[model samples]
Target: MVLISWYLMLPPPVFPPVKDASGDYKMNTTAPISQWIKFKTFKSEDSCKARLKKMPAFYKCIASYDTALKPAATPSTSTVSGAAGSHMQ
Candidate 1:
């Protein structure tokens, strides 16, 4: 599942921006969550929630983001490294 598009790069506003605003200045020109590059890959999860309900509302559909991003998934095996010196005395 993947249907992401809400990153907001910035540097292209000012189309009557904010004087009588309807929508602009996306949280003050977003782009700083490590330069968020939103994904977009759909082959399932009901076609990524059926195109995430016609987009908008920070479109999102995650299946663990299609895997392979393990920053941390700990189960606390004593934090793993060496593991009590590999179970030796």
Candidate 2:
């Protein structure tokens, strides 16, 4: 069986507050929602969630989905999909 890797997504820096469709103001993030970076890697979704629980308060994490592994015969594939966006120092 094939295995899919998960990512601990890190949110980009916040800028000014922006209004959404509902007319509620929210902190404007540096990157767009789709472009938010994937910070760390995990073997599975459950493991990613586990680490997020213990992560520092400063960081925000989101689980990554590997759509590449899925049965997508289409030719168009996102370069950033199913892969880590940033490297650790």
Candidate 3:
């Protein structure tokens, strides 16, 4: 059986609350969301294969966000699909 797993990190909130000089709460417009990243691990060769074969359309869905934070020069589609197809089969 093939072993497949991946960890995906999500972008943080766009705005974080801050305390102003007046002791009132306010949104920090300049606050950056890039610092706080949350991620979870997924491990399931059988489950992934089952889902892929049951619905080939899932490839398209996976490809949709594959290049989300990748560099401009990165090749997104082929790498993700190729890896999944090669492993699942």
Name the weakest run of 10 consecutive residues (lDDT summed) in model 2. Answer: 80-89
For each candidate, what TM-score against the reference? Answer: 0.25, 0.43, 0.24
Query: Model 2 — TM-score against the truth?
Result: 0.43
**Which tens-of-lDDT digit does each residue in 1-89 have in candidate 3?**
65546333333433465666897555332333333232434454444445555432312112213443343465789898998899997
TM-score of 1: 0.25
Residue by residue across 1-89, what tens digits does model 2's lDDT show? 66567777655554565666887554334444455566788887787888888975544444445442234355434544533344322
- Cα-based lDDT at residue 7, candidate 1: 26
Candidate 1: tens digits of C-alpha lDDT, residues 3-85:
64232222333345554365435432343233233456555677767766776555446554434222435477665756877
* Candidates by lDDT, descending order: 2, 1, 3
- Which residue pairs in model 3 clash with each other? none
Model 2, residue pairs in steric clash: none
CA lDDT of each prediction against the hidden true structure: 0.47, 0.58, 0.42
Q: Arrange candidates, best TM-score first.
A: 2, 1, 3
Error of 1 at 6 (Å): 17
Could you tell which candidate, 1 or 2, scores higher by TM-score? Answer: 2
